[model samples]
Target: MAVSLLCCDWLKEYKTRHRVGIQIRGTVESISKRFFTEVPCVGQVLGDSFAEIKSLGMPEHFCEDELLFILNTDKRKSLTLKYYARKILYFLRQQNILRSLKTFLEQPEEQQSALEGAVLVDQYCNPLADVTLEGISVQLDEMVEKVKKTLRLKNPSHPSLRCAQGFFSSKAMSIPISLSVLYMTLSHKLGLHLEPVNFPNHFLLRWCQRPRGEGNEKSYQLLRDSLDLYLTINPDNVQYLLLQARLYFHLGIWPEKVLDILQHIQALDPSQHGAVGYLVQHTLEHIQHKKHPVTPDEKRRSAPEHVEVQYSVGLIMKHKRSGYNCVIYGWDPKCTMSQEWITTMRVQQLSKGANQPFYNVLVQDGTCRYAAQENLEPHSAPLEIGHPEVGRYFSEFVETHYVANEELEMRYPEDTRETLGKVHELYHGLSLDSGHQDQASNQPNHTTNM
Candidate 1:
């Protein structure tokens, strides 16, 4: 969710006018032209394409591409649309945004997925060109199995169980709409076309069939078939809205479009029953607030870090970005990951005078690798450190921390202090002036580290 310009104040006036039934005529054509009249480039771009598809979400298997366009501090910076668009006041928004705007406009028109069609089909799923609904579904089912294996494989006896329902760890820990959203995303990415239809209970996919007499592939096509999958979602309004937001975020849906859908939802279900109306309103307000160029100074303040952490080798932790549990094996005071990863990370902006710590952990789904301190979080449940070579380093899991036995020191005494220091610094951000504590001592609380 990028910084937006349409806030509650703007919505307050707009909603008031709507409530009073004051219909404003004319398309956004006129509005965009008038609004961006001074900014000719922007006006023209808007007239051509209101918004571009920046990026989209991927299935768990494609987790690495989640934030596909990494926000580089040097390359990618953020400011409210106002500061840049309107050129307001001293905090002159960076020129990078203008560069991005130029780059965005310069991109091939085919990349503007929103303008292409609401009925989005993959490159391979062209009904007229050559694919059939049944054939697509068969292919989709196979991809679904791959998705299933990447996540929960077999169905649980109790259907409503969190794991059975596509939730990992627990209901509270994971996103509410994980299953259907991921399932639908994977199916779509695997060449199945989908769009929600008028019917409340049915989720449908629109497919066009070529006319029998048509000789040309580019001729006007007919809306001949729709692939309907029997999909049912529990009537939970808050979660439902959350899912909608996540899906829209994943699909690169524009805020204005989302606003229209929210308004439509309000009109469709006016009863304001079962939290749906409230959720809709809250989300609408959030969307509007995000669009606002002006933000209160209070919202700009960064909160202090509240977490007190003590980590150890053999201590199981979780990868923050990927949500995968990993076992700590080694640590690096300096950023010493792969050249690609290290370089990719260097563009990131961090707090002044901050140390970029690196942790060497083994991700369960894949291989052992290193991630920055900013990317690893402590895991609660004990993940039996399953790396076969665990015996090569750690002696025992004394607690949350592991200890290196006498055998390690006898073999490589030179490397012992470095290993211990890496663990110590990562766990406790302390000055060397404060005497280094004994590695074997389980006195995390007694020591001032906490």
Candidate 2:
């Protein structure tokens, strides 16, 4: 197809340019430093990553910057996330994967920079195993075309496409925020010096076009002015603002902080009063359960004295009775829900009853369940749970388990290490079994001795 040819040509040109040792833009070090210093929200999202970024100061590909960012932010020690990150970059360097960003790249460089400003949220929301840069580009292009068609139909006189509104209204159809992050990365490959702007309710990128030979202060001022003007002209809707606050909560920002924002929105628009109250109540419950959790020790006695918590966080478990896949994000020493709900679910029917440990799980069916320990089992062949809330509590999906994110770690600090140990032990046991079978097969028949 013509699209494939375009992809090949674009990749060839990009690789040729890369091989020439042309420093199109400054190293990722400088870019990351500038982003950290100028963009306070970025620093907030990725806490204390300055030291990590400083260590990786050498000039490298744009993808390396994102990989490092994801690794640092997630704080995942598992090799699975690293392996997949390396795999993506390897294919990029080897030109094994097609560059499907040809159309976006071919657009006017100015417009490309604008697109970067509109979709910089991708930095925090990194790509997953199923998310590919090429796939995102194709989707982004299709969305743009759709938006352009709508604009032409609605207002033919002024058909200037709005990047933020279009992409915001049109869902990515893949992993939630994959397209946004990949869009920023794809533009970075084109040598655009786009800096992330801390726009209200969203992350925006601004093209940093410094006076040919000037210091950062001047460019910073220009960016500030542009951001100010942009804000003044384009205001966010109340509904969008509420959604953004919810998004911040989902991304593991402080519950009190998000709640404050929601309350403020409610104050500004009385229409959202009821919705904000419900969200406030929901967030308060989340804070009580996760942020200031009562450890198993505090609940009854030390974990040794009371019922030993069988399952740790970040475990992929199958419901023995319900027959559905789920991943654990939290657990209580015993059932902590209301007695009414317990009676309704018939918790008394279980062998251990409501006294057994209960797990808070994100189910594949997009529902949250508090399953009893007796009803859960380790998945025989664990795969990633396709749940929308996976990003809220966990960061990386290891081979058979999920790696808890910082917020989840705050609640269950020991779980991440335990999950890693369990994974290693599982593989070690498998290898031992294989070795025994190999030895048995290698032994020759001693017919002469017999």
Candidate 3:
């Protein structure tokens, strides 16, 4: 998962509030919004549309048409919504109720799966439309039998079971109540009275009543008797524990807990957990605060040429022999791999041999390589390296190179700045030489028209 860096203080406050029993409302959509608001780097790197889709967990609110609108909005760099319809849309989508209802109207009565009536109720009394509370109530009452029959079904495997159960749980009408609170809060933020309404997933419209207005307001009527199933997660459930570990990693929180869960998963199923093993290794590396385990000591060098690092992290370099483009993420003053690797690659044949700096680079071919500094040159025509682990190290692509994110910066703080500085200096030197040549070409004809 691409990282979403949050404000440390905000995360601390959330943890505190969670401990104190102060509930955090809103659905995953709101959570995703908060995530993007914090980690602007994600949008910068992956493009805004990709980041937006990832945040939703499932693009329930954003169908194919809605996705196109967002994609176009990204390209045009415009489009604003005044209402909290997005939040409601996100929640409905996650509940798997949005599309099911929209498609239901197009299908026969026997084909209607679930939440068809709620979709109708929303269409009729949308907060953006001039519909009455009584009208919404009558619609809800009429759909009660259908909703009850659907909810009462004994199939535990149905995905629709997740929908509106929050309403039928200990707190009835929770969906509407929570949404009302969300509407008020968002309206306050926008300095306007607005609520959520989706025009069958195409348009988002809002309608708000004034304080002294005598007109009937739109409302949601929560249905009853929907069953909610809760599962017990203990230490033995390897799959669930693996998921928990991944969730911790995804949220960018609790490194210790992530490591522990991953370790636990590895322990529970030693033979079949190769992926878990990789995660455990990565977690351990992260915890150790060392990019390379055997970093050579430059200060206590035994020889003059020992541990002399030339290129810094984030530099785009091309291998001289094999001619592959790669980006440096780490380096050791000397080759740090085992003697077996050194022999296999024949490190002794090179000019500097095993004593020269060896960079840890992400190759364009989606593999990592540790190449001797003698083999690398600043790429003549630098382009983006197509590596899977690029996001793990870099945040954004600048004109000529990738910018290191907070994690990479922490690992090698000075490298990012120094690397860019050197590149800029080289560029300026070339530009000055070119300018002088241009000036010479434009000079007055001193040779008397020869």
Return the top candidate by lDDT.
2
**Model 2 C-alpha lDDT per residue in residues 332-377, reported as the tens digit of each score:** 8879889999999899999999998898887876667789999998
Per candidate, the number of residue pairs that clash is: 9, 2, 1
Task: List clashing residue pairs in candidate 2.
Answer: 117-205, 122-181
Off by over 4 Å in 2: 1-302, 424-427, 447-450
* Candidate 1 ranges beyond 4 A from true positions: 1-310, 337-339, 345-355, 398-401, 405-450
Tens digits of per-residue lDDT, candidate 3, 1-450, equal 224454256667555544322111223123333222222121111212233444544323234334333323432111111011233333333234334334555577655533435444454333223444467667766686576667668665555555653234323334554766676788779888765543322223355543311111111111000100000212367655666565444534335757767677777788637877777677676546422334322222234654477788778899999888999977877889999999999999999889888988888766677899999999876778866456556666665777765555655666776787777866656788999999999988678554
lDDT of 1 by residue, 22-139 (tens): 1111221123222221211110112112221112121211211111112112221221121122211110111222333334445676564331222223211231133334566577
Alpha carbon lDDT of each predicted model: 0.39, 0.57, 0.53
Question: How high is the lDDT of residue 374 in model 3?
Answer: 97
- Every candidate's CA RMSD: 25.2, 16.9, 20.5
Which has the higher lDDT value, candidate number 2 or candidate number 3? 2
* Stretch of 10 with least lDDT, candidate 3: 222-231
Global lDDT of model 1:
0.39
What lDDT is reached at residue 360 by model 1? 63
